[model samples]
Target chain A: MTDAVSARERILARVRAAVANAPEAAAVARDYRTSHTADDPAAVLGLLHENLADYRAHVHRTAPDGLAALVAERLAERGARSVAVPPGLPDAWLAATDAVRRPDEPRLSPYALDGIDAVVTGCALAIAETGTIVLDGGPGQGRRALTLVPDLHVCVVLAPEQVVASVPLALPRLDPGRPLTWISGPSATSDIELDRVEGVHGPRTLEVILVTGG
Target chain B: MGMPSFPEAAREAVGDTTLRANLRHATHTIRDKRARAVAELDDWAALREAGKRIKDDTLRHLDTYLVRLEAAVTAAGGTVHWAADAAEANRIVTALVRATGETEVVKVKSMATQEIGLNEHLEAEGIAAYETDLAELIVQLGEDRPSHILVPAIHRNRAEIRDIFAEKMGSWGRPAPDGLSDTPAELAEAARLHLREKFLRAKVGISGANFMVAETGTLVVVESEGNGRMCLTLPETLISVVGIEKVVPSWRDLEVFLQTLPRSSTAERMNPYTSMWTGTTDEDGPSAFHLVLLDNGRTDALADEVGRQALRCIRCSACLNVCPVYERAGGHAYGSVYPGPIGAILTPQLRGTSSEIDASLPYASSLCGACYEVCPVAIDIPEVLVHLRERVAEEGGKGHRLEKAAIKAASWVLDRPNTLAAVERLASATRKVHPKRLPGPGARQWSDHRDLPELPAEPFRDWWRKNRP
Candidate 1:
């Protein structure tokens, strides 16, 4: 099976090469400038907060020590009985919370995940410019579905990891062969009449926990 | 089924007043909302410029980005398959499904799947591919091809949709409740109940991503309905078929697109559901994940220096909404899975300007610039249309031959002053005996809808000499 797959891959590679070389449209160059300072992480975090708020995502901040407690308290305030945690989530982060902990399991179905009140996971990276959080199915990220099926999701971001950059700079960090999810904010839509509706596909509520001053 | 001639299919759509009304209303509503939503952002122009630049740069450095993306995804424990065309893509997906031993799959709304005719091919293999999007479900139940890009069932009104539900909902599973009304809530409820059953029972899911981040090896899908979320997460084995061009340079790059796509497409500030996934995880979601990066005609599209701009399209359908011809003629007229201005240029380029319908598509538009103004990527659709018209004329032997003959005859007569004067004299002398309409074997039908200009007492040149010269 691997051999056949390789053969098919080889054929497709040749086809792509041919298509790429075909004479068609000329490329148009676009010019745009950005005013982001990459040197300062705080500046990046500030941009992230601004963008997140712009997208209507709720933002909260705390020192590393108070991070988990804040998340737990927020969940409790929302009346969440159980919160879904990714496999690699830090145990210390949830130590302050008395809420029922539901670790994300492979066998858990969509129906099962739907039963969870909320989900919490650490992000692979956060882009401040666009107010986007990226999960690369990493340790605490779990599968894409777990984050998507639940109504509420709490994404934890370490301040230093935030990048105040363009897409070209971020591309080198991602793996093309893995399942990677990029989230801007909570799911939302507008009807034909332009009435905005939130939480149609993934989480209806998104709370970003930016742990700063480590 | 093989694609039929687009003009004939379009002729039928054009005649259907109800379908036209539905499409006009739906498209206009979305278009207006998008304008308003886009207006709320002061940096929208800058964002659009950034999105366009990123896409262009990515396409330019696609080889590097794709390699980087593949390495990242593989490193993260995901499998990636490259498919050259529709047949290859379908074969890969079918094999993946077969390996999972799943005969039925639930699908999110994916234009890539439609472009490749994935459902029909899967059905041929005795695999049932259920469309989970409400609009897509209507199209599948009605056994019809989608007319609109975003709203696949835009041609259908509430009443027609209710009838489709009444007749076809039961056979698929989860019959519509008795005495279903055409109200939006009831219709949504019926579809919700129907899809929930499929989401639970299906073991495999198929989807297409709006963007694939090369940096993180992540795939993203933006949808309004929760169905896409269900399809992405519910199944144990998930397969995503994406056009190779869907790739972006990085996660940060996605921000620019997320802002522009929703407003340009559904005319919203944000999509209701934006789902992203990278690779498989040990204890969450689908155990096995497969990414099928399909080139199909995109590489061909990319190769064209003038035509490659079409690749910049986010498939927002903004161009379709503002197009005057599309408003009256509907989507089916352009043919292929893609329709309107984008389809006119894209389908022909992908398939080649060989077929009669494809050749005709270049001429379908009125060369209006509306499509360009509304295009988020700023594709000069009219410019492309004219460019394609030249290509068609060059390739269309019969049309070229007749045009050449007509031009040669006109040149011979005009080149000589005596010949022109004599002809004018002869025409005027015979004016009284001339037919009230155009003469000749080929011109009878042409003059039916038009009046033959009254013959001047003297020719224009003759009058000019007598009056002015």
Candidate 2:
């Protein structure tokens, strides 16, 4: 086979040759707003909560102190026996839970993650207009598989801080070097007769804990 | 061997009542929801326009952006390879998998891979490629071609899927439960169980991206199911075969597309899962990453002044959902990986109109203009179709020459007032002798489907004179 350099040079040459005399692209007119709503953090959080639930994700609100209890209660309510915790997750957040905690220190294998019932992670940003929670595998967020293979995902969003009004606002705050998984609702499909059915291969139930600092 | 042309294949699909009904029901359901989803955004027009501008700008400077993308990806610990066409891409991907010494690879649903016939190529090289998406799993198990862009098996109803699974599942891996039902939830559950094993065991993963950010070197795959997540993260090696046109300039430019794509495709404010990765991270996802930049016929399509706008398509399939031709004739009729109005204009331009199938594609549309209205990038599909039709006729044959001469004669007689009136009188006088269908040649195909209109008994002028006098 010919080497990579030749292929690279050839393909680029083809592109340059093709567009040599093509019309210059017009300037991008970004007349769209950054935030569809006003710049109020609280209102953005409210919209985020409403939009998340509109897509059928179970949404809840709590303060920093109540987070451990809320996470424990939500896990128990789902009858979950084990929860996967990312390496950097705060131990105190799950201090109140009786379920076995599986910390992903060396990275949980897919088989290992499969046995866990829920995963709890912090997010990079949440877009309110789209009801999306973007996880950049930051502190508290582990590998992408940890959130994916589990039957349920309990994501912790730092309200007012993590919430952005729209996609434009969310992109600037995120670091793209880290892997990002944006969960709008749980994994769902509209494939069968175009009927929207939630939960296929991803987490069946997504419980979002909006951590508001009082 | 030559494949059957578009009209030849379309005739079969259009005549199938079951396929027609299935496509009609599926397309109508998605079309209504897509309109509702698009109407929710107040800045949708601006968003759409920005999306077009961003794509146009990227295409205009594709070589520069592609070079920048390669450097960024390599800097972030991902190896990049460039493929000029399908065979080269398949060879690169196959060798990458071989290097890992693993035979089985899991795949996220990707149009680029399908366009290159990667699965078949992989199979030829002794690699087992498993399609992890639900609809893809159905099509793969049934040994069928994908009909629609988003929902590949839109031509198959729930019952047909159950039958495919119940019959084909045992040979692949886990068997479907005895006497499987056709319920959507139940079928989804079966697929979840059937594919989960492959996801857990797969050594190498393959995917195609929705958007590739050139500045950040980030690749994004927006999907409804978590199957993509499994293939992306669980595997040891990751290879993404992305079209060169999938690239955008920056993260800032990505915002406009993220807003428009989901609403236009599955008709949601956002899809269920959107995965973005720049390169390999420490024990987070894959240890090694290979970015295969594919330029198979994309540059050829990009060279067109009017038709290059087809490259602006994000594969949203909004046009497919509203397309009357696709709803009735179904996806397989287009005779390529891409189907519907976008396919009609794009398939010809990308692959060229040399083949009988590609040539027939331009005439597939009724020039109804519905596809243009709903197009996110505002591709003037009808205008491109007419342009392509001219090219097809330019490759003139005896039939076309006759067609041109006949049109000229008709126009000449119609232009003269006396000659036009004389012909009209002759037509009404001979109304009783006129055949129900054109007797021969020129419009035999047209008259086969439709009856010639009855002579108005008298041409309008004759009736007007008799009534007023």
Candidate 3:
């Protein structure tokens, strides 16, 4: 069997030879709009709320002080017995919740996390145009598994500050080194006769809390 | 070992009424939804143009970008292995799985892996590979080939899918619950339960990336189901077999595709999940990451300036949905893992026009240009089809033998106006007695589905002379 080192050299040589006589392609013209909607923060916030709900995510709004109560209420409504909390999640965020808090210092195993009822975490950012919430394994957002294994994901997006108008605006602000998961709605599949069916492998129910006015 | 020609395969598929009904319902539903989704953006034209340019630029300097990507992935603590062909890629992956001492692997739906036939290769090596996506799971359970790029089981309706699950799930791992129904929700739930056990225990995971950012060494997988997340995050070792053409120059280049891909594919503003990870991180996700760069027939494809534009495809399957021929003939007729308009052009170029299926693929289209219109990257599929048709003609394949004969016969008759007129009059006189279909081997296949045109009572010249005089 040919080794990898020679394989690399041969493949690159073939690629160079393939395009040797080809015309030089023109430079990319990026005249596309950075944001589809208006620049106003309030309008962007409203679009985020509208689009997220359009994909069937439950959307709510609360003040900074009312956040703990809203989180607790959503978890209680799901009847969650335990919630996986990321390491840097604020204590005040889950203070009012009656569900047991399973911290991730030791890092929950896939089986252990499977048994947990829900996961609550903060986000790196959210895109208004696409209705996507991005988690980059940040302080409050645990590893990728934390949000994946649980049936219910209650993600808190700090409005205006954590929200952007479009995908183009969202990429530069993110760090590429960390693992990123961009979720628009709860897990969905159009596999069955091309009809949209929500609740597949990821969180079946995604509840977004847009906390405003600290 | 000659495969049936495209016309032969398509004729068999077109005759299946159940398959036609399943395809029509699925394609029509997604076509309208995709149109509405794309209509929401005002600068869609500009985005399409930009997407085309970015892909073109990447292809032109693919060697440099690939080298840069290798350096970045290695710098970020990921091992990069290069494969010149399918056999080498299979060997590399089999060795990786063997080194880990794992007999089973969970797979996310990937066209590259399907192209390489990775599952069968591993199974031959005494390893069991489980497909995790809901659509892929259905195809695997049914012992069928993928019919669509996005929804592999598009040909299987709800009832067929439920039946496949009810019968086949047990032998694979988990059994479907008693009394399975035809509803989409219940079937999806059954898949979720059946795969959850494998997700939690698998030691090795395999996948293909939608886009690999050369700048940051980040591999991105865009998917709707959470099965992708499970196969990606839970496994201790992750192996991604990516085509060499899947590279982009910068991290920010994802903006264009991140916006256009979802709308074109699933007709959603965004898919439910899009995962991007650069190599491996400490105590997060996979502990060991391997990036296998595959160039199986890709370098050959890049040689043709006109055909190389096919490499720009993002695998949106929009072309498949809009194509009229694809609507009736179905995807399996394309005789490739890639199906539809994109496949017609792509398969022939990658594999060449030597085989019967590959030669016939170039002629599969009516060239209505719907695939070109719906293409997000603006691949101009018709131009490639025509180009490949020329190659097929030059290469001298079986399908074109009758084509050349007919053209020769036509020129001979047209050389003499007297013979042409006499022949026309003869055809006119025999109009009632003329057969609906032609006779002979290749000619019969052509006339089987098409009716010969109704002949006029007299030639046009006779009518012109009689009236004018």
Candidate 4:
């Protein structure tokens, strides 16, 4: 066997030994059941909506063709004037809106991003069961900071790209060398008295754009 | 520094009624909120199980995963340094800061950094380290060590915080507003203003990670306040010191932890700001990023089979909130950067049960199993505590030897029932002369608080012989 294969085998053997010796391994392994059940894109999107609402995150859906229009109209409704746009954002996505589009640049400071009215980016991956959108700084996702700084963030999730799967399945798709941010919901906290407060540090408003029939 | 003895520290903590009241109220509130937040999701149990499995699996193959992580991080234009101990870690970090020619560095609340006393070390090297996290800032300004993991200033009430702010906020940068009151909003405002100035001026930033993904070489930090974001993004150079055990196998594995950690800790469904970065991005955030992979006592901790599981802790502080002993003793009594149940097990293992403090830490818990029930990673804290008690008994030598001799004599006597009966009769004859309290010096402390059970007039064995047995 090659050295790499030998190393892999050795590591796997050690892991097997460790697991066998672990006091509660059998019990824990039996409890970890795969939960993915959505059949198609529409099913996945539906699950996302259910889970998001369950987590108290505001969710919005629209047709693929009407996405830009819907996003523009949503931005307008929210009184957003300048939207931070990721570098790989589709130009046509923002074409319908008259709001000033601020391209996400490398040197942009948190203060600058805070000044922008809103941020729009494409997700690297989305887990439907948890209503989580992961931004990996890949293509339209831009830098992690861009999505974080602004008070309002609108994330675009393509129907087929998002999955209703377990973390084990999603593991293979992600690159280890990318800046990955997994966001379940908008930033929030509860004080010492158990009073829940939203938008303590990250974005106050998180609007999910589910582009269907893509 | 070594952990102090648990019984002595706990005795001191138990006597402070005010501290006890504060801790009881604070911990109970967080524990209830955490329970409610976790209960909201039906899949919380599954998520917790998944988290435990992932962490266990990753830790099992930690060496391989760490190498993979290093390669990934190096490929992504980041440098990874391995430090076998705290001194090594501090040296590497101070060297990095010195190389940058910066006199001051802004810091995120990193448990690893605190574990090694990096700030004090940095100060000794003539470099100033400013804590940017609000709780840490309060700790630094007040010249106090953190007592609680999540809320370091948890022991201090709002009025104390207001006083700390009013007195120290100006020296840092921005002063507390003219009429700073003991209100959350006012304190938060003062902290925000004070930290903003430091964030803008600092040339370097230091931090710790909640999780480091090996597959992607991505470092993740989840925080409630925006201070971490500022410290991470504002500095020209970023340095993160993270424990080796913090590495997860993959980004997907992060899902399990992300779900369980927030609800268990800060009682949030999700933290406000979860910052993740791979490496240096051209002109985005910090141009330079360096990761210090700290081992310190981890390899030593990993050596023991039963004791190693303490490493799986994500520093969520859930154990602290639920600990009855920690609720009384507070954080300062523990002496180590880690406090409470997790601290009681972890500190001794890391530092060894050599000192008065380290030796005593194992006995700090009531072994109520509340900590085990709430632990996200399912660390059997009571099991570890008992195991450490054995270790301490072995280390102490005198007690174990005496106990062994007494056990041997009892066994011999039990082997001969007639002799046992005779001895029991003699004990009953001498019962009137026996004192209620133990006669020994140390025995007084135990008897002072608790009454020794009265010896029966007739031995149980004698009664059994006379009756049906």
Candidate 5:
């Protein structure tokens, strides 16, 4: 701890010495618009859907009533036999799915999550402009590892409410205290000659079901 | 620990056909896509300007933000440590790990840690630090220096990577699967499997953040792979060594950077994953979190008015991708953890121009201004390079006196119209005496790379006077 104390003082003193003559605020000329102009919320939602698909995330839109059915259909399509489900997720969200639901509990190891076919969770928020879904492990989103280890992830976004037009708009709505995971698309890598090949270490397949009715 | 100067190492790298091919293909591919991605945004220039301003504001008021960040992180139950230099950082980190009684640690991809050479220091103190990033793992296993900032092993192609994995992975941990091929997917799988066990068992995790919020003490790491997530979540004790300049005044200020960084670096709308956490949480990720604020050479760099712009760099490799020099000479030529255009400016400023390598770095760039063009934060790297060049000449005495005298004489002659005209006539009369190649030591150095422009037959000024009024 003493190591930190001395280093802190010395570093701060040096910093003070260095920037002493600098302007008081150097107030950022934040003239940049917060987001692209798309005044309509519906247009924002459409942009989110389009951008999500553009980023290669499988995007599907459905009413509240059809949400569970879409989830079930998506699981079937992904060939998932078992799904890792967080406890706080509404029970009805998975009522239609025949895939065995693996609820979050103690003794859930990273190894077990790896064996699970897919992970289904509700995101904290989604960014329309960048085509990103953010999961904070709040209710529906299980531990970070649950969504990560599995080969596929099906994230449900409550559009219009959970979606924002841009990153600036999204940051305020989200809680910083919680561990936030902003996913633009499925796990991807451009490591080889800048050739983007989706599906790497994280969930290779990302499916976003936009539940607009709720 | 022994490394050669930039000119010394870059000479070999320049002649390396394989490294050249790898860098050329990678840089060209990323550079074109980056342009298209950047073009998609209509307000890109505004965003870039805002990014620059935000960083300037933060750096100008760095002391205030740092103290606020320390308080916020402490309030959230995370301890913050300060390190004045690399040795201090290493000592504090090693002592923390030893106190935990852990012999091994899993690390997320972190440039700050790499810059401080933490892995070697930890090893010297009998602690094994595992690098889990796919590219970093390859570099570590192959015993190679990182050539590029984003992709540490950019000098190595897929086949070279596969061979490194096959030959070296076993001694480290889980060996690459039998008969590993050169495919990117296969290589990624080998890394995932080899590093997963280490991730699960390790009690200690080390990382560097992309941005740190002063308002909430939230540390954010923007990455693609799940390895960062695993290290962030699974470990009981997490240690993050971040540069002092990484902090922003507030979360709202963070908005400007998040927009520009991804597009500039990887040319993506958004990177695959972004992790943000505030100190420690109960019954959640890491119960114990430590933030090590590093100021190794940052204060020195900040003291400089013209050189301070280099600190605005977000570690995006866009400048490197677009740099003609970097595409040929590769990363190792910079002779520091950072490389390419950003490195050419940053390394010299941080390390000072005393070392041969540091002195050589200011001359590494062609001053083409491609780096300044694509810089998200608008770091004027060429300006800093020229600034550092003056410092190197004045202090390091690397600039030759003959070149200086020649430039002074040319200025004296050109300053007077009559003297300039007389000299032009003299040069035209003695054109044959000028020779096809310079007769001094410069002849060999000049002919080795390129040809002289035949002295242009006659000076442009004389031709203009004779033909026109």
Candidate 6:
């Protein structure tokens, strides 16, 4: 056997011997509240908006029909010359935008992605209690870099459908096999004198559009 | 030179006015914010209980969960390596980096790596390891030891950091901007520009995990700045060296910690970024992933029943913030990567009490019980400190022998009532002529910092008998 294999065996033996006379651990009691917020959908959506803004993410609410125009307006407001479009994003979402479209057909290199001015993608889910949005690299959500590299990220979250009330409720809905990124706000750091300063490395500007009605 | 005891080390720190002010400002700011954040959760007590229980369960069956975790990570196309101690772990990582023919690697700020001294070891073998997190970057550039767990350079103020960056950044890779100011925002921008070049060109990345799930084989990194994401996502070959006790039994266990850790560490609703990945992803992140399970001295700690709960720490640094002793003495006084209340108990167990520093660590606290109250896992640090003190005393040294002899003499006198009464009467008669301080080696040292209590005018037994009769 190799050295690594022998080491593994020895470590395991030590662990077993260490706990041989130990008493059984008490069963984990999970009586903690699953959702701190009420069960109403409007309340959950409202909480999500308040939290996202609390972390300095600019938030806006709009109807599904107004999303394309809203997306175009956000991009133009940021003065973005180019926007990276993730695979399977609805074609009409960018119909009204005149900015050059950079799709992830052949995945963009890190260097190339850095040059893009903005990225617009959909999310897998959003947690209200924590004000978090999780991206699983599914349909509208591209690879992690699509949202990470660009200076600006315009994330579209379909409300009432994709929003959850708490973290416990957010876990089971996520698939463990896929790569996940849970973003609460734009990149920030509290390293200097323990004072928080936003916009470090990840998308410095996070614009979230909560689409209320399909 | 031998390392000084905790008192010797703490005395110097207490005298430094600048360090005392820095610790006071930083710790006080976070303490208030953490209390408010925790108060928002009505069921915080239940969550803390569940977190403690889940970790207990995981440690109880660590062998089973580890084996299962290895299998799951393997099935997901990642290779698992086991390291029995720090030397072997360093050897494995060095060889892995050498295999890729890369002399440089980007790193996320991880306590496990700090515990093993990975960067120093790698540097000895001709590799350059760059720390990406903003606080870690400050420490690395300044060539200073980490004081706080979450914020390694908490000892530094804004001016000190700006000086370190301006003076050292050029030699590392990118230089700080000309005429750089001391503002936190400008300083952070300097780090972003410096690390971005390394991230874009890096072939290998090294990290440590906050949590590793046994059932799904997923690893989690909870971080504040975007630096963690850059290193974890940009590199081609990602290597994570995590302690053996980091594994949880299942994925659902994260719900408890996700709520508690953010509030406890940085006092935030949720940190800016958290990355979760299982093994390797095709064309998404790293193509090849390596998970190193490090044991160093954890199994030895596990063998000790009272000392084992130190393994449940999430490295939140909350205990360090509220500790009165830590506030005055600072993190460097603890003399290890782990510091404050957690370090006082943990360093002794992991490193053993043979050395002077380790022996003195258990006595570092005043037994105020602040650390116990703030601990998320509720490890009674004072209980473990007293238990370790018993073990230290039993080892039989000069001071302990004197203590034992003194205790024996007191017990003997108390057992004989007549002799005790005679002694009490003599003490009362000589009270005016008695010396202010006890004249002895051990007793003199004890009385140096504390006032000698005055002898009572009369013994309690005599007063009680006369009054009652």
Q: What is the C-alpha lDDT of each candidate?
A: 0.77, 0.90, 0.94, 0.78, 0.87, 0.92
Better of 4 and 6 by TM-score: 6
Tens-digit lDDT track of model 2 for B1-469: 1767777888899999999989988889888899999998888888888989999999999998999999899999999999989999999999999999999899999999999999999999999999988899999999999999999989999999999999999999999988789999889889899988998888899999999999989999999989999988999899999999999998899788898999999999999999999889988889999999998899898888888899999999999999988888888989899999999998888788887788889888899999999988888899999888777888863235765677789999988989999999999999899988876674787899998888888899988988995
Error of 4 at B358 (Å): 1.1
lDDT of each residue in B311-374, candidate 1, tens digit only? 8888988888888888888887777778988999988888888777787788788787888887
What is the DockQ for all candidates, taken in turn? 0.21, 0.80, 0.88, 0.23, 0.68, 0.85
The residue-level lDDT of candidate 5 at B443 comes to 65
Q: Cα deviation of A14 in candidate 5 (Å)?
A: 0.3
Q: How many angstroms is the interface RMSD of candidate 5?
A: 1.5
lDDT of 1 by residue, A1-214 (tens): 6744674466446445745654432443333334334557677788788878777788999999998789888788778888888888988888887878987664466678768889888988876655777777778888777787667888888887655454444445665444556677776533222234444445767899889888
Which ten residues in a row are the worst by lDDT in model 5 chain B? B396-405
2 versus 5: better DockQ goes to: 2
**Chain A: TM-score in each model:** 0.82, 0.95, 0.98, 0.81, 0.94, 0.98
Using Cα atoms with residue i matched to residue i, what is each candidate's TM-score against the true structure? 0.76, 0.93, 0.93, 0.82, 0.95, 0.95
Q: What's model 4's lDDT at B123?
A: 99
TM-score of chain A of 2: 0.95
Q: Residues A82-196, candidate 6: write the lDDT tens digits.
A: 9999998999889999999999889998898988999999999999988999999999999888888899999999989999999999999999999999999999999998989
- Tell me the TM-score that candidate 4 gets on chain A alone: 0.81
**Of candidates 4 and 3, the better by TM-score:** 3
At residue B300, what lDDT does model 3 achieve? Answer: 92
CAPRI verdict (incorrect, acceptable, medium, high) for model 4:
acceptable
Order of candidate numbers by lDDT, starting with the best: 3, 6, 2, 5, 4, 1
Off by over 4 Å in 5: A23-26, B396-399, B408-421, B428-434, B447-469
